[model samples]
Each structure stands twice: as structure tokens, then as C-alpha cells.
Target: MVRPLLRQLLAMAIVGSTAGCLITDRVEFEDPENLPPLIESMAPPAAKVVRLDRTRSEDVSFACQVLDQNEEDTLDARAFLDFARDEAIRGVTEVVQSESDARRRSVTASFPPDLFARGCHVVEVDVIDGGAAGWDPGGQTRFRSVKEGVAKATATWFVLAYDSEGDPRADISLESCP
Candidate 1:
């Protein structure tokens, strides 16, 4: 009876190890407190989305752009735009890639007249490949949109930081011009 039990235990162990052999698709990101090595050293960190408000009758708009400070479009600009559009709260516009630098990537999202509201709007500011860590077609920086009241009439900013291991360490929230 003892011998049979030992064999059974060995078989179970082998099976468990084999099952865990496959790579698990998990990527860890940071909040606004911690940032990657590359960004942390760069002069003047990128701006954040504070608050967004707009009027419906004119060209009242905000620029949603991304800047690749490394002088190359290392991150997927298109993907970041999609994330902003899909994740932005109501009254938020699309994110557009604006500039690239030797050490940074920036994107600006505009608030169109149709989407602009009167209160504090929520916005998610995702800095795609902030550190040029790597090209991850399946990776992204995600965080909750800044929550502000519609009547406050104040702007805010949020930043998502990442590292080479594809891990984010900080997510920042800031106030912006109306």
C-alpha cells in the first residue's frame, strides 16, 4: 500500500510541473507613485490630464498626442489612441501622437465639442512604452480615469509609468487648464 501511494504522489507532482511549464501571460503595471528607471532619470516628466471641458459651438478642442523621446516611434501610437478612446470617460476626445524625443513618448487627447461636459471629467492618461522597454503588441498601461465633478470646472492630469520588464510602477494624477 505504501509503495502504491508513493508512485501516485510522484505522478501527480510530475503532472503539476508539466502543466506549469507553459509561460503565463501576465504583465504587471505601476500606479502614479513609482516610475521606471528611464523615465525617472529624464528631465521634466511628461504632463498629465487634469480636467477637460469644452463648448459645443466652436473649435474648442484639446490635443491628444504621444511623444517618443528616444527619437523613434518605439511604442504603438495607434494602440494608445485606441485605449484612450475606449477607456476615456464621456466628454473626452481621442488621443493623438504629437511628438517623439530621445527619451520620452507623449500623446495628447482632445476634448471635442460634442463630448465635452460641464463638470469634472474623468480621463485616463496612458503613456505607451514610456521607457522604450519593448514592443508589446499585447501590452499596455492602464489606470482609472481621473474623477472630477462637472461643476468644479477644473482640469487634472494622470500618468501611467512602465519598466523594461513590462511592469508599471506609478500612476500619477494632475490638474490641468480648462
Candidate 2:
């Protein structure tokens, strides 16, 4: 009789455990297709920037590639050339124009002796597009845009002079400059 009672208890426990396993409830999530089109359109639009390179040298150079919104519309090439000429007359002492083998559309302006003293300094470069011109300040150089009149994109780079001859001999240990 005890054995029969133990078997009945084990059977009751098994049935109780299996009861939970047999339960099923369906869950559903709303489809994205049901959402309004404006909800997806609220996302930010794609953005892009012009490529620029900054290098330190006793002599500096400027290189730029024409930008194109489409195959039919390209940044004016002559505008860049004119800007290069003007920069040479300004702070840039020497300028050399070269064509890149990698991209046929780029022009470079090389400066033989970059005009700046070796030290920590701020330089300004300008970005010019059509009638608007803006300046970008860099610790060592400035980028400027040179194009004027029609909306053409142009940028100028300013380089800070660094003395690569040797390590700085002296430095101030003060908490801050007065």
C-alpha cells in the first residue's frame, strides 16, 4: 500500500510539472509598413565634406581637387588657379603648380619657404564658395576659401612654422601664462 501511495504522489508531481509546459500564448508586434512615411523621412539627410590635407614644412604647398555636384556641374578650375596666384603674392613666397598622376583634376601650389616662425601659433585658412568666404582656424595652420563671385568652392591652408632642428631648450613650468 505504501508503494502504491508513493507512485501516486510521483504521478501527481509529474502532471503538475507538465501542466506549465503545455501552456501557449501568441504575441504579435506591429509591422513597420503600417507606420506613416513621414516617420521614416524624419531621419537626417546624408552629408559630405571636401577633402583637405595639412602638412608642416619650411616650405608649404596647396593642393585641391575640383568638386562636382553631378557629372554636368564641376567646380571651376580657373578659379583655383587664380586663387593660387593671389596666395603666392600674399603670404606664400613661392608657388609651384603640378598635376597629379593619381587624379587628373587636381592642382598643387608649392611654397619654397613657408612664412611662419617656429612655435605654437594660430593659422587661418579660408573657404570660399561663390560670393561667400569663410575661415577655418588651425593651431598650426589656417584653411581659407579663395573663390569669389559665382558660388565656387575654394579653401586656403595656413601652416604654422615648427623648428625641427632640435628639442626646445627651455620651457616654462608655471601653472599658466599671465
The most accurate candidate by lDDT is 1
**What is the TM-score of each predicted model, taking all chains together?**
0.30, 0.30
For candidate 1, the 10 contiguous residues with the lowest summed lDDT are 145-154
The local lDDT score (0 to 100) that residue 103 gets in candidate 2 is 16
**Given candidate 1, what's the lDDT at residue 134?**
34
What are the per-residue Cα lDDT tens digits for candidate 2 across 81-150?
2233243223321211224321123434444443433332222222222222222233122234332232
Q: Candidate 2's error at 56, in angstroms?
A: 11
Q: What overall lDDT goes with each candidate model? A: 0.35, 0.32
- TM-score for candidate 2, please give it: 0.30
Candidate 2, residue 177: how far the Cα is off, in Å: 17
How many angstroms is residue 39 displaced in model 1 relative to the true structure, after the best TM-score fit?
7.2
Off by over 4 Å in 2: 1-58, 70-104, 120-149, 156-158, 167-178
